[model samples]
Target: MTTPTTPPTAGGGRSEYLHGLDVLRVVASAAIVYTHLASWISGKNRSWPIGDLVNAVTSPLHLRPDLAFIGVASFLLVSGLVVTRVSLRESPGEFLRRRAVRVLPPLWAALILAFAVVSTGLVREMAPESAATALHLLNNAWFGPYFVGGAVLLPVVWTLLVQLAFYAFTALTIPLLRRWPWLPSAVAAALISVTTSLVPQGAVGPVRTVVAFLPIVFIGQLISLAQAGRVRLGAAVALGAVHLLLFVRADLVSRGIFTPGGGYHNVLLMIVLLVLLFMSANGPVARSRWTRALARRTYSVYLVHMPIGFAVLELLVDAIGASWALLISVLVIAVATELFYRAVERPLERLLRRRRRRRADLERPVDTDEPTPGGNRDGLAGRGADAGRSARQGADIA
Candidate 1:
């Protein structure tokens, strides 16, 4: 597989890789886990033998503040920034192909395991029909109620669908964006802001959720462009302020657990993260092998951690006591997700890319002979082409 390339800093030397982004990923993962664990602990009809104790310990957290949703939005922001940086170097077709290969295989692997868990009747709350559920979920149309009767085995997958839509939109718009990136992005942000304002807070279902979050994604794009000097910093800041105001005005900021004290904390947290993103844009970030490894597995962790953690919690809570069950569940699910990354996600992604490259090779016209040495022949020129292609591939994976 091609190695990832760090985005160049505004000062023009080879910029340091963004270590803080990975730290943000880690934070997002933890926030999501916290939200889900709270949900599991406080879920209704708790007839498990240890329910009373579990509630006693975690009941303070029973407040349904959706910190997970905040984390998801943050993820989309970072993702949008990264994708915009990458797409500048890729054709639309190449961008879509690489994205599909990078995301779909691992997600499908997670889905298969998730389905197996559901089929065993472990997930009694939302057992899906074996065949139809697999097909519908695999298809992953942006509409809600992925399975029949509006039962979603893995509600977390909804964000993935929104992400896919964003990818397609980005791919389609890359050409237009090349010329006047700022104006279009600003207009799009405004549109999303208006849309979100029109939608009621509690009434944001699947479609509305995607619509509301798109502005955050646009903010990421704008920040990236501004960081790269393609857009004015002042303009980007103005647009971001408008977007944040719209988001807060919609009451969306108050929906999450991290939003203590009437959502000021949420706003502060977002500003802090954005400041970190800006600061990291131009500086060397400390890195280590451990962080790199964890960063590599973040997506896999995002995919499988929630459902598996909940499953483990349900299976072990009564027998082991609440604290131990929660602890064991986190560790077990994390390790299992890491194993899944190594065994299934990585291999499947590599295989898909190999097949894609092979297909492209077959489609290219055959050259009977190498070019003459003086005529820009195969050594340096060919290597340059290969390097560019590799860079594009690497950027996509990032």
Candidate 2:
């Protein structure tokens, strides 16, 4: 999940950086990576020594490997809050542009990289005959696999499509949201509730998945609005309750569509715990250098860890033994994640920021020597500086 640079204050000024979110991001990413590698993958390849150990530890505890998707729940919450914060301060067009710039390039690059890796014959299981087809890559690149019946090269990317849908919804409803922060979410929750109830079982498929997960995002948005004092805390709580109910109902209706996990109740419990952590953890430890650094790399890590880690494990397991191979795979994932962040994500973000600044400069009026009858240039300059600060804070969320 992306961290906001700074949150806007209740009085429309900048607030302190939410260092706690960094802590949450670190936890969320670790949970996800660990779940996939230690639980999910190990369960699938039962021959691995690490799998045996993981199962031994987890089985007694009654932990389902799929319950690890609580990490995804955390991410959706963070994304909703961050995106809402950004949308509040930006024009719809600007908001969409920032989101696209933030999300798309890394995804496209990762898709290409995954395709290349699969083509290399390093991971034979992943390298299906269809893997070489350009259409398969295109399908994944466009998230057609999630919408249609097709293989997803990177399974985690299904969330990205959901995020993109949320972005579009937020952008479209920005005007209404600015006017009445609670209205859009309330209406959406009601609509989803009705749709989920009325629609025949299994008919909506992808649409059901999208709508089912949307309430989770809305809960995040409501939290943001409450924090910003745009909506009353009580009202936000009520709206969040409604959304949570809708989320549960919809998720239950489409139970078989997703990989069977800890059920909706378990997911809800995880979400509540994550939110509690977010609310309670905000001290120096959360603001530590290591936490912040790890937070920045979470998105990059989420993007590449799975496909790349699997490839490394599959390639090295026979030669190095399971324990050593697992260790090496993790090392490779870390290195690749860091490189991808430095080489792809960070640069694209900087380039977009530069382009945005240049466009803003070009759109500005020319400086003139003549002073207005009542307005002071100094006062105007001060206001402009304030706006710049707000814009910078807004960009942090994106």
Candidate 3:
């Protein structure tokens, strides 16, 4: 599908976006789900002392601050890497369509369902904010805490706005940064730090946190772009070390321990995870049918988890002890996710694909000299009579 306009530096591999990045999406989404489950079970508290007792009595430092902080950063890093691949070649129209298809419907469903299922007065609060919050424009009005219930997000979806911005920012700046990648990364980090410092802590803190988060997300993109591709061994060692350091030293910083932000240390951690994901995606580990299937339905899983998890948490609190609730909730979520995927996501995806094919056929180029809408043939990624000629004449980056 090479065309006359694609950037040669893009690696020009059609499977690059499809198989590589999809695998990482599967991995990152699963990690985020477990993290959310853990929070719900513990009533949003992770007692390190008790955690230490368990580590001493049972396994290793599983729920430690250092570990949790890095895990979250890893998610952001994965976001930066995959988003770069996605944004790099997408036309604005295609980008909007893909993003809307991937994010919106499930988000709407989750907002409604989570509000319906969660007791503890969550539904009461969401009842008033549901319509406005679903719009996302008004989500800032209630941002009492970064991941707190005041935000109308099903759970961690608010961070996705930062993700969305990162995608847009990267796309707009690609021509500029493709030549000097470090410039964008540095400025982005500086901006995030400056914005974070300006926001006074308290009621305004959560709302302001979104502003602070942008640069970090961009930083992740820059790090991936800078490496020029995969950064597995070097990135893994660097990230693993930095993540540990940030986890241990988070208390000294103002952004709070095990949370998304602190300073340079946290930003580095996020970048490292992103680089790691990029490297991993470049490999074949996550290209299996199971993982692809899992990635296809990740949006639904994300939406349903909060509301469903809340209901399960209520049940577990009354039945199982709070300590065990997180462990159990994740297992329950996996089963529910499978059902939701088969019942909801797959059917809609197939329908969309069919409609898209029909559109492509309708827009098929005539055999005459007039150009197509985008100045290319329809239905193909870019295939036509000119592909071989375009490839040889240094016109391959279409």
Candidate 4:
């Protein structure tokens, strides 16, 4: 069997070597973890002027309010590029199995843990209706908007929900997307960008939220196409970048650096940077062996950070005092997150892959040695292929 060229952690020699983009992806994930840990590890003291002053600067630093977005948005771009690339190459059967086994399980772990904390009333202030939302794995609207900043448990899972929707659509549409090539992505980006100015504030659902991002995701697909000589890189890059900026700005929603609107434009730029990183990543990224290693563990840290971040922040409050602890807690969480990624998440992923591969091989059809009982032996291979093809088409339904 041909091994695909995806990032491989140190677990197996067979791992897909991570390009710079992959390493960057993990860094973003870790940052999200650190950002949340800042809140979690802090102890509450209402009246400390000195503490307040320190926290004012330190908390934002961990949060990176300046670049809060690049993490999750880049997460989407990576998913879009990688998933679409997989969608084109792999059979639907393999894609679904790998996605389910590789991604959904670990994600579900964080969601369940978060729900447990909420249900038990240990953390009283998370959104109320989020219980139902949590069951859907953060796809539901119950969690509300407060957690949009990646400060809550399973925060990153929100991106996965959008990804699932896109993947579901892409699975069936891949054949068609392959045919027309540019139609789905072009329409998605165009409609979102144009509609952004049209829609009033507080619009909800896909259009108000991630649906608008369809164009952004499609742009990644476009980037991939351009690289393959399917389109002109200069034209795609130029048009895509312009729309991306305008979307990020979102027509002066808040007119501040900290505002979150105008994701379209930010995402556009993020994707461009990702493309560039993927191209020139080797020299700078590969140079730092430790940094690349850190990238490998990023997802693991992301999964564990939500619960741990809060605990760390809460503890930091008493140990170091509110303001100072908050500063130190960020560092502590970053170190702990690295440990978690190395110890738990990465190992489990490798184990699952081994078991999955073993099962898949065992399940492969075994030819019979018996002579043909009739004039023509049954064409089981053809039947199996047809069955698989039908199932793939059916499961792809949105």
Candidate 5:
């Protein structure tokens, strides 16, 4: 989640604005939608032509349709890039605050909607007993299945959990990032990442999952540094390549690594996807009003699309057939996302921003009543104005 702002350039130089990132957001959302849609279709009929087409196109390397995890990977890369940009301009508190405001409200709404769907038997992914746990619904707020035990309203929430963890980690280390740019921290993180992988995983499986993904997230941050010119492009690329290798190797070596269907092929696809995304952001895609308007709802689309889309699919698939049902589901998700954005997300974000601004204004220290040396009201150095006035007055007296 990134907020656009006028960022000061490196070494106090001119500003650099990243246009077309909204386009990337839209693409990432669409990729995610397609991924889930393909999965649904494949589940319905493994021999379906459309499902096969999706599998072929999406998983060029691994040949498994599940390689659509590329969408989530791209989203994470975009997030890392944007998060680093925002982090450079914001204090850690402000960074975390904005992240929460942007991410959480819509998420909570989606979780509730998901519960309603499951409760009504609109979707049968979760059992009634699972839904009845109630605390699982609340715990889904934190993506805490590891702590709360296996009850997730929407399975897509695992990505959000990874995202929030990244946000928390970035918020804590943002000061260090700003101070050292990317190289030193990345190197240290890479070392720790490798070391963590070597640690045998038995009881601490969740810890391994977190460690597994941290390197990928760091690759995102490195891309941001390169884009901002805070780090040399070549160096960033080299380090990224190393980190990528480490990630794949760790997965291969560590038995607990989560590669859904594709092995090293999925990892390769992610690398290519990140490269393409970086190139697209730098290209002449250009920011557009239409793209921005839709991109504003991408978060809503992401949060609710899977569960809601699947529910709509199941409801309509028998009546209209799977192909038509899938199209209808897409339309339904689009309309719902727009409504969620306008009715819930935009309003909540605005209210939070207003409140945050008021709080910040109140917390900001006012100029003290005390005067500076030589009688300035504020505690800033005098700029020879008092002496100039005295000289002019003396000349007039003379």
Candidate 6:
């Protein structure tokens, strides 16, 4: 869901990482990939043999095709928690810059690759005309499709757009967050609730989608703030509960009842499960080698899975049997995700780290006067040493 950021320390000044969240990311990525390839695609194309097979297998279990979207919710929660944790020590400008660097380049590269794949006619589901023009590609690349009424090049990018909006909200409200801690989330909840109620039924749009999702992210932030001792645990829990209720209300207002299964019941179920997981499972499970490896690439996998994996499945399914085709498609996804991570994600992350280091160095006060051996020349030198240590600490966590 999120790149590993420094986690809050436990009591007694002991620093600990929530490797469990990493494990959850890996699981969430797999769930979404499976949902798309097996559940969603199969549901869409009933004539396909894989569809029949998937339906036969899953129907008895009563699994909802869209249940895997809980993975997206998981990601949003993680983004809020991790991003807020980092933001505590970062200036708003630096936070936005770092977030842009971490998120955008890989997204653009994936869009380019998706455009190339679609142009090759490998993805039978997508019409060539949809992505035939450079302008259309640019629209999707820049996240203009949702606003401008064009098809999104990569459909999953809608979530990233929401994430970007949350980043802006976070940056702008950092001052309030630092002071009142819970005020921004409360205000966001109130605004979203009022806005959704005022809008006409079934008229949910991008604005509503973006606003509704903000509270979910804010829920994550409340948890992080509580962990960091910025907010009282009781207060954070109460605020988080209120935010979750408002989020559910927004969902109900915008989408109404979604289902063969009692209207987004699973959505609330999943969020509850995720919170429980975050509390109980945030530890040793992530220490596994394979788990860490998968977690590291989850973001890259999320970026490319649908666009690339679906194409592979469509291209190969007719030639091979459904099972083999699905297997191969998954393998292709794994390889492509790895490559994307190595080429785009990792490089940009290194650049971000370098930038942070440079900033820290620049911000560190320099002592022009020679110091006595093993001692400070003055209080300025001591202050400089403290500032440098603080900067380094911030960089490490960031």
Query: Which candidate tops lDDT?
Result: 2
lDDT of 2 by residue, 1-398 (tens): 22333444433423334567677777888778777766534544646655566657856545555346667888888778767766875679978988888788888888888888877766445445457468888988878876776766777887777788889989999998989888888888887888778767677346777777888888888877777667887998899899888876775677565566545456655665566567446678875779867887888999898878888877777787767877888899999999999998789768876887677556554776453332223221113333443343335434
Candidate 4 runs further than 4 Å off: 1-18, 37-66, 119-153, 177-180, 190-207, 238-271, 284-289, 322-348, 351-398
| Per-candidate alpha-carbon RMSD to the true structure | 7.1, 5.0, 8.4, 9.9, 11.1, 6.2
lDDT of 6 by residue, 158-202 (tens): 788778888888899888887887787777777777876776766
> By TM-score, how accurate is candidate 1?
0.73
What tens-digit string does per-residue lDDT give for candidate 3 at 255-350? 531244334454355445554555434335554667556666566666576556655666675566665665566677777777776666666566
lDDT of 2: 0.71
What tens-digit string does per-residue lDDT give for candidate 1 at 1-398?
01225333222212234455665656667767766765676573344445455445644544224343546766777777667766654578878988887887777777677777776665554344452365555544323463223556566777776677678878888886667767767666666666665655555355455764566667677766676566777887887777666555545432431244454326334643653554363223325556556656778778787668877877887787666877898898789878998887678666755765676556444774444332112211112333333233234333
TM-score of predicted model 6? 0.81
Model 6 lDDT, residue 302, Cα: 83
On TM-score, who's better, 1 or 3?
Answer: 1
Clashing pairs in 3: 5-397, 5-398, 6-397, 6-398, 77-274, 114-307
Clashing pairs in 6: none
Give the TM-score of each candidate: 0.73, 0.83, 0.63, 0.63, 0.79, 0.81
- lDDT, residue 39, model 4: 30
The models' CA-based lDDT, in order, is: 0.60, 0.71, 0.48, 0.50, 0.63, 0.67
What is candidate 5's lDDT per residue for 1-398, written digit by digit as tens? 12323333333211234445566667778978987876776777634567666666755466446446666676666666666655665567867877787777778888888887777776665335357457778877777676546567877766666567777877788777767776544654666575665677554435566655656666777876776567776787887777676667657666645645555446445554655454445343545567656666777888778777888887988888877888899999998888877887878666754764576456545765444344233211121443222222111111
Lowest-sum lDDT 10-residue window in model 4: 374-383
lDDT of 4 at 213: 51
Error of 5 at 335 (Å): 1.4
